[model samples]
Target chain A: MKWLAASALLFAASAVAAAGGGTRTNDDAIVGDGFAPVLSAYGFFSDAQAQRPAAGVTPYRLQTPLWSDGAEKQRFVYVPGGKQARSRGAGLLDLPVGSALIKSFRFGGRLIETRVLLHRAGGWIALPYLWNADQSEARLVLAGARVDLTTPAGAAISYAVPNKNQCKECHGAAGQVVPIGPKARNLSAEWLAAFKRAGKLDAVPAVARRVPLWEDRAAVPVADAARGYLDANCAHCHNPDGAASNSGLTLTWEETDPVKLGVGKRPVAAGRGSGDLQFDVVPGDPDHSILAYRMASLEGGISMPELGRASLDPAGQAIIRGWIAGMR
Target chain B: MKMTTALIVAASALALAGPLHAKTIDVPAGNNAQSRLQEALITAQPGDVVQLGAGRFALSDGLSLDAGGVTVRGAGMDATVLDFSAQKGAGEGLLVTASDVTLRDFAVENTHGDGIKSKGANNVIYYRIRVTWTGGPKETNGAYGIYPVSSSNVLIDGCKVSGASDAGIYVGQSVAITVRYNYVEQSVAGIEIENSRDALVTGNLVTRNTGGILVFDLPNLPVMGGGNTLIEGNMVIDNDTPNFAPKGNIVASVPRGTGIMVMANDGVTVLGNTLANHGTAQVMVVAYPKAFTDARYNPYPRNIALGYNTYVGGGDAPGFPGGAQLAKAFGGTLPPVIWDGLGGPKALLPSADVKVLNLNLPAQGAGVDQAKPALLSFTAPPMIAVPGNVGAPARLEERIVR
Candidate 1:
């Protein structure tokens, strides 16, 4: 939980350094400040088109993944041989230098984009790579791209691939980039244990309260399912130290204070995004809650998770609505 | 003496760093502006100048700069324009996360969000920048125009911002802010200093906004305990624009034609200002008008000092509730100063010659039903003496002067 790795982006070099050593993933790409120009240059995959990981690359799943316009995600944690990631109680795992986290977003069986969190000498740096139309390889797209496609909800939308700095907008904490998705509570217990047994993690973390699996949310309490979704999607930027800290709305799972969590809390600088509505979350009224309202918006300034998601997630919106509707 | 020496060093540093190892990169406005501008921002190092050329640069996504000690200069506010009307992604037009940055001579129009925002960027200067909505004042306009938050030693001068749903120039959760010589119109709050300490607002032409200038400290914010600000030497006039801010926002409650308002803050002095044509009182001191549960929050305005200022052609058409009743007691119109009677004895001190009204309310968040309005004749404005910490550093003042 205390892993506030020093500034990984402080020494990002413009040149593409040599990626030497490591028969699996490229060690130089993970250890150095230089960013690889191509996604395949990092060597995290044996069969890039088939989504197959190399020898040391381990695939894992989050309990409730971030909703990216209903895109299917394939996740992997790449740790060098003999180096284990430190597992805190419930916070983000402390990956050593020369480690990387990879996530690929796929829509309609086609790879759209892949984001990588590389732990270098200084800190963690987040980079986005866009896959070509052939699905054979992906190139580094620091400027980001927009693909016109149909979402899972049968809506035609222009999906945005976040630029490099936009990657930091969600991943940054106190001006430094850090990983957000690998918190112990957000990861499944089985995955954690298996990863530990595989010598990838230092130890299996014990989560006091695990977030519910999004697919099986019906079996859990409404608050857990809904709050879990929020913790995974909104908490990255909404936490106190995150990019949207000025808004003072912290959505972390441990943020139990009602007012701090935006319950009946008035908007300070929401502007037109507030829909002239009052309170971020009105008890028992999902329609009036600004949280639900922003989640459903597709406009540039009005949308929640402003950097990502050009289209709305109806299932995610329903979870937030359910949470607010159950509140009293 | 120590501060003067430090400021001299700061000025010297700025001058010395300008020529050495500093190269200017000129970027002309044309197709592929989004990628070109964004790439220039990324490749720019410290002491580099990203010069924007004349003409309109149409952008789709928001651009950001993270390199410290860099300057983004444009041809002119009118000549070099960044139009974000077709924006598709990002929250604001430009987001700066680095310190010691200078953004100047740029016009940002029709942005889907804030025009230019510098967060956690200390020692930032925004000079001669313009942010406007061509469609005029509407509820859909972006929130803030010149927004610098969570930083120290900030300066915003010679800027023009209009049609913001929120404040035109907003400095929040920051310290040592100075907003001066700016023109702000058709916004909810012309220039707002919120949840910050040691601010100076002066020499601005603030007109046609819902409220001229606001000094507020609200609850549940990351940074609180705002105070020690001076609002002075500005021509605040005709701020009668209807509040077009979205509902639930704090600024939406601002009464139309509000000249100057200080709410829930401490040690704020209102002095040396020219005001006119406000339907609300020219200057209002009130508490936070909502019920909050934060233990760290203080909802009362403390030690509010009001000075003698020029007030012209206002106080007839009152916007807030109970203004009619207060005007009725005065036989025609209300006074120039209005205080919500919630703070204790030390709450207010005003000039004797200046007319004052006391909205005698019982408690915080009380409505007009509990108001017992009357003119205050006993309270006298004390001599205004603020701490030396107020306003931006002298280094910033030197830059504006040059």
Candidate 2:
């Protein structure tokens, strides 16, 4: 099945190259129309086709991945009009107009949805596409959809695709629609080296700061693992620049303030989402923490990350619990 | 392909006109209606109107509008429905973050989260809208039916909301707001205004929720010190529904059957309202010190006035915890007005500072107990007015005509 999926991706890429005539200049790629320009001129999922990065499309991996209804995700970044990827600070290189961040989600070997983040003159805009059952095509989905499927663990679940506006619910940072997960701390040394070998890196810094992947059991400390998990799963909206900033909780990896990182901190207007707990996080007591209660709840009014995943992430929950338990 | 072509034409038209000319983009009813509507919203000019036809539109994801001065309208609240029962994504059913935007005459149902939420938007109006969950009120229901947070110059009128586990119509950390002529029921809190400033809540029918209405100022928020609010001329009755709010939320502290609860706020005036048939007190005013865990918050309820309100048929069955506490403090049945006169050193100033004027209910039926000493007064900082909502556009009254 893995081999079949890989071949399908390769075939889709070659087909896209054939359809768009391989190499194209930046000037010809006009995005005046919604995402049609992305499809026809840029050949980024045009014809509802599911395609991987052809020649210049570079695949990358994050140190930690956000949880999205337990779906497997594939990520690719494309520089606009075949431009070189240039590093900006410790984050992913500054993307030019027409640059695209493409992520495809799959459930049990079935392609489910592909989310594309397009960088335009106006800023970054997120567009999601739903794949058809036959795997032949995917169509741009603006409203968003809900699908019911059985996971590999045999749990039946309802998965939501998230609408265009829902995209900004997390992506909107510092009052702008921006990308997440490509920050300096999320890049792996090996991936950076590969990008440099591919001539995609403008300049790789010496001793690049790294956030250990949540599943990298051998290399990460318990505290670092917990923080990385939070950064990937919650910080997109819980950061100082994110939507939940009003709550006074900043889950970003860069947050140095202990209170903002939810140490014995109280909830502001969490309403009943507080789970009757007094503190957002209580050191040495997972049972007494509001964060643990919210994460464990499947109820509508009291879930963390608030949008995706109807079921609990027992492994993630255990990690958070263990971290809280071990805290002073 | 056809839809894409249409979207391109629309985009071209919008690009040519700049932000001046107003255009109408009609969205047909179908499975793809959500996509089409989203496309229109993305391509719409500043003054454009996105109109939804009279039909049920099935949507998998939520929708949003981020352009200023855009109006999204539908045939009627009941006629045009956006159903998200099978929602696959996360977040509110519709999220709007644009200033000067107006939404009207539509229903959002069964969302995975909030029904319609506007965040940090100014000069926004929600007119003749309905937000609901089909099932009865439960903890699994969405947190809010209609939610506007950290926004300014907001108006929500002639709307119906129900089946939220939290407040059905909730406005949080907002300013210059007006909520009127709305019907809210079967939620934990019928309508809640929290940590906001310069608000007016009146002329609404609030019933069957755990609590009728709430005005609160919580600690540890970016925007705090909510004051200068008026709650008047609303029917707050029979709010005896059990609380279904998740734990840890401040509203969970509210007793079931509460009519109006004012906590830790200042300069609030409650007048000319009808309160009836609540199992708890008709009105309760209390300080936040005992319940608060955040030391940064103000623990006093100051400069409050409660008068000219008609109260009837309450204290039949005391609510648990608070009601039980009130019963223990002041005999068997709960009072019409229970004031836990706990304040931050300011309680010693005078009994008249927090006035209860011309209340026709029995004097004995009102309870006031100051738990703290008056000698330990803490001076409060000056209240800051929440900016925005100046010269907001005229309210949309076309729904009444329709």
By DockQ, the best candidate is 1
Error of 1 at A83 (Å): 1.5
Query: How many steric overlaps are in each model, in order?
Result: 4, 18
Per-residue lDDT of model 1, residues A222-295, tens digit only = 89999999899999989988988999999999998898788989888788789878999999999998999899
TM-score against native, each model: 0.94, 0.80
- Note the Cα lDDT for every prediction shown: 0.87, 0.74
lDDT of 1 at A275: 80
Error of 2 at B54 (Å): 3.6
Cα distance off (Å), candidate 2, residue B190? 2.3
lDDT value, residue A274 of candidate 1: 90
lDDT tens readout by residue for model 2, A115-171: 878788788888777777787666666666767887665678887776676777789
